[model samples]
Target: MEKKLKKLKTDNARKQIKKNQNIFNIWTKLLRISAIWIRFFQWRKWHKDHTYPKPQVGPLMVAEIQQAKERWITITQRQAFPEEINSLRNNQQVVRGPLRTLSPYLDNDLLRVGGRLENSNISANRKHPVILPRQHVVTEMIYREYHQRYMHVGPQGLLAAIREEFWVLRGRDVARATVHNCLKCFRARPSSLQPAMGQLPSARVTPSRAFAQTGVDFAGPLVVKLGLRKSTTTKAYVAVFVCLATKAIHLEAVSALSTAAFMAALKRFMSRRGKPSHIWSDNGTNFVGARKELECCFKKQLTGRTVPEELVEEGVQWVFTPPSAPHFGGIWEAAVKSFKHHFVRVAGAAILNFEELSTLLAQIEACLNSRPMTALSSDPADLQALTPGHFLIGTPVLMPPEADYSEMPDNRLKRWELVQKITQMFWKRWRLEYLSSLQSKAKWLNPTANVKIGTLAVLKEDNVPPLQWKMVRIIEIHPGKDGIVRVVTVRTASGQQLKRPTVKICPLPMGKEE
Candidate 1:
């Protein structure tokens, strides 16, 4: 009996070995037909004289196992709908589940939708797409793959494309999350942060002497004739000085944009209107140079044993807004706009000599200063609406004479008392009319989340598309007094550093936390 059992086991082992050898031969032949090469010696070792070695695992078996491992959708479906699959196979009706209403059924061991469109002539995949769980990893991969395949479309479009072959549970929510997480989609249509509007600077709201706190800006490269007889022309720019307190403007024409030219214009401005205590301007090249020169002058005077009193008295503090931020110097920018509006109409296409241009600028300045600072009153008894010129010279620069208060009784008012009273009245009106108007924000009413250090962002550029905007990494943030981040310092991909306002920086969806 023992001898018979041993013989039977040997026969079974031989039969198993022969089956594996035949499968290996078929795989080798297929590889050869597909132009894949195997060493002749290796082939000979295995198949010499039509005799095979002991059977081992083959490439076909390994490949089949790998393919089965990759079918994550099947594994998930089996885990989620084992009862539904079993019931369908046994021809039993599905009782209660998310898929009960869909009338799901098994096709090739995979669950699919069995909706009313079974009789439609459309493709099988479209009529009954594979149902997937919304929160599963496989479903996310499929959503992302189809999203990119269709050119990173919006949530609805991505869902529509996915439903042609897949019916993801809560597909709209999944599609939205996928698109929101896509780096390319976020960068293509990025959103910039808009913090709440900041408080007005003290220089702008406080009452002071005209031109005491001033902002300066350049207006144009206006064409002016160099000589009347020769018709030779050159470019001339207007230097606009605006009072931060009163909004009165003074215009000076410069032959060129240079340190010396700007200094000369500054001297002219001070000669007409007294030297300002503080001057604010954008960081133009000329302004930067002027600031450096002033610093050097101060250093030299301090080093000397006997400093000149005139130099010390003439010292002016210059303030510059961040580079490339024109909005920071909006007071002077608005003044430049007012200058252009009048200059364009007065000068037109006619090119005038330097003297004529200067005269025209002076006339425009007078007109701008005379504009009403407050709304005009319909009642005739009310005093004329206050103007910037009123703060400067106690009346409109272009207005006609009014009834004389000089002849009033001594008890009513003296000359000095009348002057003081009129000055106080002007300031009181300015506080009630001009300063109160700034309380309401015109835009950016709501604050957004502040960008932190190490966040990725896109630097906005004029005349450039959003896709072409440079990627940047935030290295620093400059928050306002209200603790809202309005500006940030960033390093670009090329390693260049730039300071930009939050309005010009489009932050990516994912930050350092991700």
Candidate 2:
């Protein structure tokens, strides 16, 4: 029985390998065809706009054209393209000009259009009709002949190169179609512009206290000396908390990424910045593990851990963005980048102890958080850049202070009302200056149609040939709230499914639906 099972497994493995080989062969064939088309297009383009050495049409080329014309005429008499011939005849009658006259001509018992024959009177002139067959084979042959001479120009240029000696009926359209389907051309094409920006989340649009709705992310594995020894090296991580509403940032230094270290960092953040109503973080293992432990504490699973009970009851929610989707947490991610940029320069070539590193991190955090929230005014009289500090402390960090209201009479307003007035003023400026800045899109200007389910696509791989490109069919579309498909689920020939962003997928050209 065991022997039979082993034989069955071997058979399945062989079948799988054969299937993969077959798929590879199909892709190879497609790419080969695409290469031919690309070369033809390249030759055509250069021959049109650029000037090059005129190619001499030998007797062999002339004889080949003559043979192709004869073949086409034979086919035409046999009624292979009776409709096309009849249409041409009708067109010749309706037109009255040199072009109309040129549409009908006889050469060596075969009907030809365009190009005058060379004679002794015009020995310098090389213009002549090089008749071509109706089949794709003859057209490609003509393209290759001129392509080698013109050094692979595109469609328009190639047509110009051939026009000096030959004219094929509807050659322009045929050349264009071939160029459009070229794999080489497609690979070299620029990336398509992205769709319009999606709407801002409520956290960004709403006005709230600093750190009320926050995004948390970690940065760094900076080297810090342990104890007093210069050789004892330890890694330290920084937990960065960014306020979604006010863009205020808070930094915490942790020794490790364990649950205990994160919890300690979170406690310090809550103590100084106040408890966050909602915490948004990426799907990191540490973050996820922390959430699970917090849940256990919230559910009273651990004995004597009752301090977080009230905080849980009051709705301290932790939300995680999708796995592998870092763009979802771009706000905090940007903060992390700014932090790393400055920290790297400040701590250059020095390995500081934990206490020293902690102080430097705090200083860097303050510098980043004080950066302008909106564009600076150019006028000298209008001082003070609008920054996150304005929302947190009611003024810019380095700018001169305004008139103090702290010493005002007690009868003027209650303590809560005074705070409310200041907050309201900050919000008013935030709406006027910050909100307006969000209107312009910095990238991805053009909108494209959404990729539909069941559409065939090729996965683009860098430094890899098109024949090796993984082929798949769209199984599902994951559209954003803006009704644009950004991500999709695809199924391969091996029956495996994968989730990929639209940028990585290259849809195959197909006919329009009827």
Candidate 3:
């Protein structure tokens, strides 16, 4: 009985295996048939839609073109010129529509202009072009097609080309808009936004201690001899510090462009001109690194209670302008220019030693500080005009000593009181003269619309062609105290974010949906 059972089990297992194999074969065959059908259908679709090498214009093709144009014109006219169409159908004049001046009439169910040029010896299409409403999609399509056919010509040329076939309403305005919206034209002639000049910062307009609020910048890699030998030479740089309130400048010579060198220069400046409450500079790598180091030092001193009370009270506050924006630090930039002007004229290709360079810079600083800040008076008896030197010392750095007033009995003659009175007088003149002069904007006199987030723009790069400039999308804006946006943060196509002034961003024309 056991042997008979074993034989039956083996037969049943073999039958089950055979049944599973048959099911697998059936599925594989079905998959192959489906794939073959898919390829066959794709080929059929390609064959049906493919264009012939030399396609003949048959009656069917002509009929299809006529039908499409009629459909498009019917939809467009009904949406835009329904009243005019009704007036024309009733044999009345179009008195109130935009087409009233054009004297439009229907011919073969299509609108055409009834202009005085009807008798001109030209083609029918040119003599009385088909009238199109400007706001409709059909009009846009026709304008775009003609604009492209003319190889992206100017507005006047584009308008003339379109008038050869269609007389679009407000054709000039439409043509201008179409040209403005072209990506290629915009990329070739990208114009940056010109927001109105911003209000002067408090540091610039208000009177303060000389060098209290400072703007710092680096000048150059001036060639300098290492020693008396002319062959042994090394590169050096000038650190220019300008007082925002007084326009006084301090120059320091540094050996290299590094954070350590900058720190040393800063120490020298503070030791001589006093520690500044705020320091403004461009986004140079050395400046950024020094700021970080200073922050770390300040934190440690505060935590350990090692900093003196006076030092803590006079803490340094560093502010950085947006990257690649030199205009933001115009004060120091101007000073650097003045310094170079003097240095170039005086030094004149002469490679001096480091000490000689330092001395020359000091003399130039004195000359700059002694310059008249306000216009000179015509009256010869009037006291010398206020200068940056007045805020630094008691008088101009280059002026001769005045007659001693120690013997005078006036209360202002007292040493401390006289000094205070002199300082007050200087500030009064600054407020009335220098500050007022800054009220008038040098350029960018008109206000424009602010750029919005998600708008596409091109970044203006120095020494780069407009076509090669990177494309960016505005993501954020930085408005001033008066609520004018001058700075914005943008993201590039490579996912890099940059903070740039609006003057460096050229926004592109937006579509209706955008």
Candidate 4:
């Protein structure tokens, strides 16, 4: 009997909830049904709201959709749209047309209007005001205003323009393009040219002789390790070397990159694989800052080209890449990639400081030299992997280098025709074949072509026609549509008003950029 009474109370509570739901509002009308009935009868309410009076269904349909468009600051679109709406109504224009939705206020109005019309059973997708998207019109308006006011753009100029002038902020080129296309700028964009077939990049420099030349690249200033026993933050760096002919690599890690570590790396390089004839490193602090600064005294000047002097003493020629041309330092850069891929997989993070770091370099170098590589040798058809040591094994020490303090003996060099002997000794055999077949036809070492106004260009200061050069300032900046740029002096000390001369820029036509 008690269980029956408790069940009765629970049923009463459920019935109370059902009765309360009848008062809930749905759409324009109040619902008056039990919760269970509401669920069961929802389809009837929807049909009553959505379906037109049965007789009205046979008439041809007429409806409008509204979308938002940008408006001028001077006009309130609320006024403009209503006036347009009244005109449409009075004219009895049967054609459904787009409504211009402007501003968020306008767009919100249009959205609400669309929602209302949708609620009233009209199609929301067709013939709406404000067809131009908020993002699109704003972007167009801002850019159009800017291009009219400021004709040219710089890196800083562009940044400032985007912030204050262009409507879309920061690196939003896609929106800019959209706006650009919709506005006056649509007529200004140049036609794109047909893409030419890409030529194969030349194989990395193949020196005339083996072990005669080597290239260098920096790999890391890896995250400092505190200690194997106690972690403390201290730094270390890695340097890499690659042979020109065989493509084998050498890697070394140094503690603090002082003159001391630099020298130690050189010594280790020489100890393992004999000395190279030529060395190529970028203008890095480690390679350039090894010497003390020169102080002018009474009569004479101190001369120390630090790393270059060291290379000269070691009988190794030194060549540096033209500034801004990392492509020329291809070998070591490739080796650097391999090092990163290998180091991450193998290096232990617990080790820190120079001592431990330098100790690990040998193991890293071994891994780099041992990896199988598929880059074609001088011969396009041949492929091989000769690890650093493998290339040296059983090779005749033809001259049995004396490792003397002074230069080679005159007789031995004379007998061997040193230059020819070195060339034949080290060049990949396939290269000799290629050279034998190569033409001596004329070509420019630094190719260039005819210059035009607004032709994108990079200036060359030190890279003139001579064998060696320097680049200090941008000698030419292409000015679009503003034809000839004539210049007399780059140094403002000389004068600023002088005409600027323009030079042909990069991606020079095959034979032209020389």
Q: Whose TM-score is greatest here?
A: 3
Query: lDDT of each structure?
Result: 0.81, 0.69, 0.84, 0.44
TM-scores for candidates 1 onward, in order: 0.78, 0.67, 0.80, 0.40
For candidate 1, the lDDT comes to 0.81
TM-score of 3: 0.80
- What would the per-residue lDDT of candidate 3 be over residues 2-71, giving only the tens digit for each residue? 7998678645643443343324223223233333433444456467667523332323344444544554
Kindly report which residue stretches of model 1 are placed more than 4 angstroms away from their true locations once superposed.
1-70, 76-111, 114-116, 303-314, 377-382, 402-413, 463-465, 511-514
Error of 4 at 449 (Å): 4.1
Could you give candidate 4's per-residue lDDT for residues 300-411 as a string of tens digits? 2224444454444455556765444454466678788888886777665555555656666666666655553333368766634333433544232222444563464567
Per-prediction CA RMSD (Å): 8.9, 14.7, 15.4, 22.8
RMSD of 1: 8.9
Maximum-lDDT candidate:
3
Model 4 weakest 10-residue run by lDDT? 64-73
Ranked candidates, highest TM-score first? 3, 1, 2, 4
In angstroms, the error of model 4 at 31 is 64
- How does model 2 fare in lDDT? 0.69
Tens digits of per-residue lDDT, candidate 1, 103-212, equal: 89887778899999978999998999888887765566677777877899999999999899888888999999889878798778887778888889999999999999
List ranges where model 2 is wrong by over 4 Å. 1-180, 183-193, 256-264, 283-285, 288-297, 300-305, 314-325, 380-383, 397-415, 459-470, 492-496, 511-514
* lDDT tens per residue, model 2, 1-514: 9799867864564344334332422322323443343344445645864664333232324434444344433333333334434555565331543335455444443445543544435422233353443343335545555654565567898777766655556678656654544444444552332455567789988988889999999998888899666689989999999999888888899999888999999989999999889999998898998889877777773356656656657656899875555776889999999898998898997998988988998888778778988888889997466788887777755556678876866854587797788778778888988988887877767788888899877765568776677778999988988898877888998998877767768876542110
- Model 2: number of clashes? 17
